[model samples]
Target: MESYDFIVVGGGSAGCVVASRLTEDPDVSVCLLEAGGTDSSPLIHTPVGAVAMMPTKINNWGFETVPQPGLNGRNGYQPRGKTLGGSSSINAMMYARGHRYDYDLWESLGNKGWSYNECLPYFKKAENNEVHHNQFHGQGGPLNVADLRSPSDLLERYLQACESIGVPRNHDVNGAEQVGAMPTQVTQLNGERCSAAKAYLTPSLTRPNLTVITRATTHKVLFEDKKAVGVEYGLKGQRFQIKCTKEVILSAGAFGSPQLLMLSGIGAKENLDVHGIPQIHDLPGVGENLQDHIDLVHSYRSSSKRDTFGVSMQMVVEMSKAVPQWITRRSGKMSSNFAEGIGFLCSESDVQVPDLEFVFVVAVVDDHARKIHASHGFSSHVTLLRPKSIGTVKLNSADPYDAPRIDPAFFSHPEDMEIMIKGWKKQRQMLESNAFDDVRGETFYPVDETDDKAIEQDIRNRADTQYHPVGTCKMGTPDDKFAVVDSDLKVYGMSGLRVVDASIMPTLVGGNTNAPTIMIAEKVVDSIKQQYALLKQTKTASCEPS
Candidate 1:
C-alpha cells in the first residue's frame, strides 16, 4: 500500500545512481528495491576480495548460459551481481569509459544527445579521478578513480614488451586514446573498494526522501492501460505492493531488467505465450541481441626474480609492511589494483582501430576458479574488441522466481574465432619478446608445442566470459523490430517506464561496463530532471491567477 513519487528497481550500478539522483529533490520521495542483501561483506569492501566473490552465491546471481554452439556446445558460466552495489562491488574494479566511437555509434543510430561529446560530461561528472584533472577527468565526483600503487616489476616489462611489439604506451586509457597498454585505474577510495553503493548510495541513505529495502525481489511492474503504476515485490518471506505515482525505472542490469520486463508481459508476444504470461505489450526486443566479451587467459611462469607471482608470499608480507605506511601516507602496495596493466592491439595489421585487447594480471589464473600453481606467474587475457556474434535471453519458466535462460553464443561468427586465434598467437609472441627473455618461464598451456589441434582445442576449453553483458533491450528506431527503447531510453508503447541500464546499450562497449552503465544513468538522470522541471513549471503557471 506504500506509494512514492518514483520507484526504482534493482540497486546495481545504474539503479543506485538513479535512486540517488532522483532523491536529490527533497519533495520527491523515492524507493529502491534490491533482491540481494546489503553490501556489508568484507569481500565487498576489499580491493583483492573479488576472487572470493567469484565462486560464492552470496552476492552473485550465478546464472549459466545454455549450451553454446560456438564453443562446441559448452555452457558458459555467467555471474551477475545480486547485491546492493551489484557487480561493481564484485568486479575487478577496472575503470574504463569505453571508446568514444562507441557512444558516437549510438548517436548515429538515432540516439540524439548521446554522442561522445555530449556524454563526456556525464562521465566526468561521475568520476573523481585522483590522477589527472584536465578535460578528460573531473576533480570532485562521486566515483573515485586512481592509479594502482603496487605494480610488479614483471608487469612493467610486459608494458615494455607491448611497446617493443609496435603497441604504443598509453598514459591514460580514459583520455584521448584507448589503444595502448596502460596500467589499469580502479574504482577505489583510500585503498578500499568504491562500489556504486559506496559512491552514491551510502551518502544518500540518511536522506528522508530515500528508502532502501534489500532482499526484496521484484515480481512484476503493475500496469494500468499500458502505463506502469507500481510494483509487487517480496522481502524475506513477506510480500508487498508499492505504487509509483510518477514513474517506474528498471535498472536491473542486462539480464535482470529484461527478465523483469518479460515477466510483466511487456516482451515479445510469442515468448509471453510460451511462458504462459498474458501479453500486455508486443515489444519483441526485450531479450534479443545479447552480447558479451569472451576472454582467453594465457598464463606463463616467470624465470626472472621480479615476477610478482613468484613473490606473492613476499608481496603479502610487503603489503603488510606497507599497510602501515599506507595508513599514514595513503600510498603503497595497498593501493594496487591487482590488474597491474592492459593493452589494446590490432589483430590485423591493416586494421585502423585496435581489434584485440589485453589485460595483464599479477596473479596466475588458469581455470575459471582454480589457480593450481603456486609458482610466480602472470595472466595475459586477450579479448576480441568487437564481436560479430549475437545471442538471446529467454525465460525458463513462467515463475517469477526462476532464473532466465541466457545464451551468449560466443564465437558464432568465424571472424570472432579467427580474431581470438590471432590474439592468442600475439600473446605467445609477447611472452617470447626480449623484454621477457630473462624473465620468461614455461608456458602453462600448449604444453605440446608441436600439436596445432591441441592448441585450438585448448582455446575452446579454456575460454570464459569476461562478464560484460549488454544489448538485451537495445535502443534504436521504432522500425527496428528488436529495439526495446527509443534513443531517449523510453520503452516502446509504455507511458512512464524507462530502462536505463546496460540493457539499453545497442552493443557492448569495448571495455569494462561499470563506467558505461554509470554514464547512462547520469545521462538519463539529466533527461528526467529536465522533463520533471518543465512539468513543474507548467503546473505552477497554470495554477497562478487561474
Candidate 2:
C-alpha cells in the first residue's frame, strides 16, 4: 500500500487545491484521487467548449436529477466536471466570489472564523484577478480571474438595457456591492480556461511528493473505529488501498461528497439500514441540507444575430472562421464563456441583500444550450439566489459506481415561486426596455404574460438549476442536529477526517459557487496544517535524537 500524509479524494475544485497547497511544504506527501481522467481535453481548455461539455460526458459527469416535483415533475440536467478541474473545468468559467454578507451569515450561524473579514483573505489567497487589484481582489494567486478576452457588442447592448432599467453598471460585480450588471470576470489565463487543475495542480505536478491518480474511483473511507485512516479505491479494474498517516479529506463536491459519506455508512441510521450497509457513525445530517440556485431563462431572438451565439448558416460560416482565429491568437468568438454578462439584485426591496441573480448569455441558451436553434438570439437567466427549498443526495445502492439520487426540491416554498415571478417581471421589464429595441427580436417563451398567474406558470415551466449545487454536508455548531461538519470543516464525531467542499456551506452564497468552493479548500487546508503541526514536530524529532 502506498502511504501518504494526506489523502484528498475527488480531484475537482477543492481536491486539487487541497493536494496542491499541502504539497507546498515539500515534506508533506499528498495523494489526490479523481474518478475521471486528466483535464487534458482541448474542449476543457477552451472557454467556449463548455457548451459541448454541458450536454455530453466529455470531461463531465452529466448527472440528471430525480424528477423535481416543484418543477412540474421534470428532471433537471446537472453537468459536473469529472476531469481534473472538476466542475471548474467544464463550467461557464464565471469568476464570482459571491456577496460578502454570504460569509457573514456563515459566521452568524455559530461558525467562528467565517466572517467576511476572516474569509476575505482566503478568497484573495486563491484569486489572481487580472483587474481590480484593490482590497477586495488579489493580483497574484493560483486561480486566474481575468476580464473577458473578447466580448461582443451584443453584450454591451444587454448592459445598456440593464442600465436603462435603473440598474447601474457595476465595474466589478465582485467588488463592494454585487447588485448591478457587468461583464463577467472569467477564470481564464491568456484566453484559455484556468480550471483548478490548470491553476493549482498543474503547476505543482513537478513536486516529487505530490501524487495525483486519475481514473481512480474511491469506494469509501477506511476507518479505525471513528478515525478515517485510509481510502479504498479502484483503478485499472483493480482495488487498491492507500493509508493516510495524517488525515482523509473528502473534496468530492456537493453531491459526490455526501454520497460517498452515505456509502461509507456515516449517514442517517435508517438510510444505512435500508441499504443493508453496516453503520460506522450515525450522523443524520450527512446528506441532508442540499441546495442550489434555480434559474428561469427568458430567451429572445436577436435581429442582428451577428454577434450572438447561435447556429445560423451564417453563424456556422463565422464560427468556422473564428475557430482559426482562436487557434492562431486565442482571441475570437470562440474565446467566449457564452455567459458573458451577469448581475445580482434583490427580488424584493425589503431584503437586506440581493436575492436574485441575472445571467445574460450571448446565445439564446434554452435548456443550458441543449435545445439547438438555427436562429440568432440571446437569453437572460433570472436565478432565485437564496431559495428556501432544501434538497438531498442519497445513495441509490451500496455500489459506489452507481450515481446518487439527487433531488434539489426547487420551488417547494411558495415564497420562492413568488420571488421567481417577481424576477420574471423584472427580467421582462429589462428586456422590453428601449435599449434592446435595436437587437431584441422576439420572445421565444411565455405564450402569454397576461397576469401574475401566467408569469408564475412560465417560471415553473422553465425553472431549473443554475448548476450551483451545494450544502449536502452542512457545517454547523454542535447543537445543530443536521450539522455534518464543524467550523474547522471537521466531520462531526469523526477523527482525522473532514469534508472540505461546497457541501459544507450552511447556506448557498449569493453568486457562483466555484470561487467560494476554491476558497473553502484554501481556508481549510490552512486549518489542517495548523491542526497537524504536531505531526511535523514528531517527524522532525524521529529524524533527530531518535
Candidate 3:
C-alpha cells in the first residue's frame, strides 16, 4: 500500500518528462511505471540500427491496422516503441517541429495558449541545438539536435534537383520557414540516439524524490466516485496497487493510453457496455480521430559504381579506419542519420502549405530492412502530410496484452490518393532530371508510369505507414464531445488525471512527430508547475489567519 505525491504511468516520451519535472521540488515525491524494459539495446543506440528493429518485436509494439478499404482491404503494419524511450528510441531521428499554422489551428479551435509563438519556446527548451543559439534554438538543453554528420553525394544531387525544380534550399527547417529542401536535423548526441528517456529520465534516476519502476503494466486507473486516486498494475505476474495523493498522468502513447482509459470505464458508453465494464465517464473521443502518414517508396537501381550498396567492402574498411578517428575526433560516415536528404513540396501550385515530404536514402529498403542490391541502389520515399482521412483505436477484448484495433483508413479521402499519385509523378521527373543523369538507372516501382490508373493502383497496393500515429484523444474546449482533454491537457470530467502524449494532439503535425511529442511534454511540465504553485499558495493562505 505505497502512496506518493504523484504517480505517472507509462514511462515513455511524456511520462518520463512529467515524472522528472514533478520531482524537481524537494518536498514532492514521484513514481514512474513502465511496462517495457530498459532501452539498452545496441540497435537503439546506433543511428543506422533502426532498420533492423522495424519488423521485430525486440523494442516495438508490432500492431497492425484493420483492413483499410482505401488500400483494397489490406492490413498495414504499425510499429510503436515498447522500451524505455518508447518510439523515440526506435525512430528515424528526424527533428521537425511542424508548421506554425498547425498550432494556430489548435488555438482556433478554442484551445487557448497554444498558438505557434507560445509553443515555440517549448520546442526550443526541449532541444540542445548543437549548431546555433538563437531565440528559436537553445544551446545547452538536454535533448541534442545537430546537422547530419555524413552527407552523401547522391543526397547533394537530390538537393540540387529540388533547387532546379523551383524549391529553395533551407539551411534550417525548424527556423522561420519550412517549405524547402534541407538536410534533416536529428536527435542525436555524438552519433547516438537521444531519446526522451536518455535526455530526462536517465539523469534524474538518482534523485531521492523520483522512483522509476520498469516492467510494470498498468491495468486501470482507480477512481472513488469521479476522482482518480491511484492505479492498479502488475509486475512479474504479481498484481499491486499504489495510491496517488496528487495526480495520475497517462503517457502510454496514442494507442496504449486510450486503451487504458477505455478499460477503466472512461470511454464511449456503448463500447464499455459491450465489453461488460461499468461506464464511469462516457468520453467518446478516447480512441477516435486517429491519423497517420502513409509513405510510398520508389527505388532505382543505380548506374554509378559509387553507391553505398556497391561500396559494402569499402564501407567496412572505412568504418574500421574511422572508428579510432571517431573515438578521438568524433566525425565521419558512422555519425550519419541514414536519412541524409529530404525535400518538402506541395502537390498543387494553389496550395499554400507543403503537402508532400520526400526522404532520400542511400541504400535500398525492400520490405522493412535496408537490403543492399548487388548493384548500387537508391530510394525516394514520398509521404503525404496532413491527410484528410481519420480512423479509430479500439480494444479487441478487455485484455491489456491483446493488441488494439487500429484502423488508419489511409487514403479514405480521394484527394489523398490523388496527392500520392502526383507525388509519384514528381519523383519520376526528379529522377529523370539532369542532376541525376550520371547516376540514374531503371525505375524499381510502378515500372510502367505511362498508364495513369496503373500507377495509382500500384501506389495503393504498396503504400506503407511511416509509423507516426497520433490524435486519438484530442485536446479542445468542452463543446467538442470528442475532445478528451482541455488546453491545459487535463482529462475532461476527471480530477487528478491528465494525458501528456501524442494522444493530446488535435491533428497530426505536418512532419515527424517525435520532436513535437517532446515539445508537448516540455510545455505541459510548465503548466503542471504553475498549477501546483497556485495550490500551494492557496493552502498556505487558508491556514495563516483563521
Top-TM-score structure, candidate number: 2
Error of model 2, residue 58, in angstroms:
1.5
| Model 3, residue 454: C-alpha shift (Å) | 1.2
The alpha-carbon RMSD values of the candidates against the true structure, listed in the order shown, are 2.1, 1.6, 1.9
Cα lDDT computed for each candidate against the true fold: 0.85, 0.90, 0.84
Residue 418, candidate 1: Cα error in Å is 1.5
- What would the per-residue lDDT of candidate 1 be over residues 1-546, giving only the tens digit for each residue? 999999999999999999999999998999999999999997788676677777567599988899877777788888888899999988889998788888998888888888999999999999999998899998788999987756677777888888887888998988988888888888998778899999999999999999999999999999999999999997778889999889999999888889999999999888899889999999988999998998888887875434454445765666677768767765555455557887888897898767788888776776655456767767788888789888888999877789899998898887888778778878777767898777667778753534556656777887878889999989999788989998778899998899989989997778888999999999898889889999999999999995
Which ranking of candidates, highest lDDT first? 2, 1, 3
Off by over 4 Å in 2: 538-546
Residue 350 C-alpha lDDT in model 1: 92
Among the numbered candidates, top lDDT falls to: 2
**Off by more than 4 A, model 3:** 303-330, 370-375
> On residues 1-546, what C-alpha lDDT tens digit does candidate 3 reach at each position?
899988988888788888888888978999899988898888888776686777788788888889988887889888898888899888888888788888898899898999999999888888899986777887777889988776677887888888877667988777888888888788888877888999988999899999888889999999998899999998999999999898989999999989999988999988788888888998999999999998988877776544444446665676787677656755665555667777778888998988888887776766555344665677778889888889899888887778888988898888888888888888777767799887877766645777779888888788878778899989989999999999989999999999999999999888888888888988998998888999999999999976
